[model samples]
Target: MRSKTAKLISWTTGGFLLVLAAFRAPAEVTYFLLSTRLVGSALGSCVLPLTKPEDIAEARREMTLDQPPLIPLVRITAGADGINRDYLAPGKPSWTWHVTGFVGFVEGVPEILESTPALVERRQGGWFHDSSGAATVAFTGYKPVAELTREQIFFASAQLTANGMDLHWVDLGANYLYTVETSSSFSPANWMPAPGGSWPIAGTNWVDIATPLSGPRFYRVKAELKSP
Candidate 1:
């Protein structure tokens, strides 16, 4: 009888060990599956778009232009009174603006030096003009203050006149690439050699006489100063 009890006990112990082993197999498999899934998720999230050789070539071509990236830097800030405006970003105060679009239709008076025509009289900032054709107009104010003054201070100032053709505006579709202007258009003149610095009068650095909305316009300080 004792021998029979021992055999039964051994049988029960063996059964419990087998059941535990069976349950452990699935636990091990579940752990492996979870680890593999996490790895896959990490890899998928880390992938980035591959840069092809063609993309590099295109970037190089865009960089070869004479002016700043013509797409993003175009901006014009005009005041409600039509004066106290600014064309250039704070980072580039010396750059002027260019006007394109309907070159033939847009007409305006020949830019007068220090005349401060009624349109921009006493205005010491920036302005913009749209063209009537497919092109857009842009303008800049290149005023470099020679000095600054306080209660009883004085400064020297200069004028940059855009004296060429009269700018006329008409609604027309004539898409054309923006062509830079000549250097003579933005040459500083009438330099007042004085003892202080103050804001000067307004002048036509660049102007685009287009319809209400022509398109994107480009502005710069030395667009015409590019190498041939």
Candidate 2:
């Protein structure tokens, strides 16, 4: 978004030092020679293109030159790059130029948000998911050998008869954990794991430990997953 003054400065780097030279007692004279050269150099580069169609049409309509291709004698002095990166007439400051003159622009430049991106509320096709699951263990039927005293529930141990009862469960996920426990009484504090009470499987499962009419056994299923 270079300004006319900045553009002019660029073109005259090799010559402007001469102006410094002329200013010092130790310097050489720049003369009125630099003035005309500076003006000519600045104006010469001013013949540039309008990028937008509307600007081109506006230029054609308002053109005020004695010459056939003459555009307005005055111009905004900014090229398309400047107009884009800085400001165009619509957003310009309130000021006027006389003839081929223009004010140089700096500061108040529009900010560019190159880093921030649009918000995404949902995705269309692909998905990012962590594994999840549900599980249940059920004992279909059971019978007691005989009613036992509070003290006999454990040792008098009921013999579960051969009946059409079932124990089964399923877990379809990446990980599953289960425990089989037993108790002498239904008291919560008395439960403990039965013989080979626990096992770890690579969890993708449809498990069915369909034991029929079991003798006081409890089972619980838990599924879990960790992915990164």
Candidate 3:
């Protein structure tokens, strides 16, 4: 009977050992890191008005901005999950962001950061005129501060003045491509710059008419983002 009891105890001990062996520790992969059903998460976030002024300057220079119109930016902080760590895994962490997409018709602005590493390229386009053929100004912008960045830019119609044709606008600033084309008739080829030259205003508006536009003429402002 004692022998029979000893054999039963041995069998029970072996079964317990097999159960322990079946339940091994999980791997480092995040897939199985969480419980069967997830509850809370560790998502990353960020704020605007960047800490680095140089980065802001780079962004402004890329857009060829010489005036202040209150730019907006979306700052991002990488998730501090397993991703934040270096190759060593236990090393200190650094943040990064991947910038892409349109700034209103523009494709993929600056790509600031990436885990594997990348680059930020800003390409400003040339004169974009409306073929619809109406009283409208050409559109060109490189304000990468925020997506869909809107600014009040209008090219007022040339008015007849006592001295000459006075050209002014309600709101316009840092227009590097402020080229005014005037024509006696409504023809593309006939349209040319004012008597002096194309006045590309870098900043400010309301310039006194030096060259008198004596007779009736057509005026259209072409704003183009020069190639950077």
For 117-164, candidate 1 gives per-residue lDDT tens digits of 122323334233334212222211211111111110111111212432
- Given candidate 3, what's the lDDT at residue 214? 42
lDDT of each: 0.19, 0.21, 0.28
**CA error at residue 66 for candidate 3, angstroms:** 43
Ranking according to lDDT, highest score first = 3, 2, 1
Clash counts per candidate, in order, are 28, 0, 0
Global lDDT of model 2: 0.21
Q: Which digits, one per residue and each the tens of the lDDT, describe model 2 over residues 89-124?
A: 132211111112211112222222011000000210
Q: Give residue 68's lDDT in candidate 3 (0 to 100).
A: 36
What TM-score does prediction 3 earn? 0.28
Off by over 4 Å in 3: 1-157, 170-175, 187-189, 203-215
Q: Which of the two, 1 or 2, has more lDDT?
A: 2
Ranking by TM-score: 3, 2, 1
Assess candidate 3 and give its lDDT: 0.28
Model 3 C-alpha lDDT per residue in residues 1-228, reported as the tens digit of each score: 010000000011322211000111122211100010112222221112222445545544544444532222222222222122122122222224222211222233343311121111111111112342111111122233321111111213334356555554322212234555555553333765556654654332333355332433445454444445
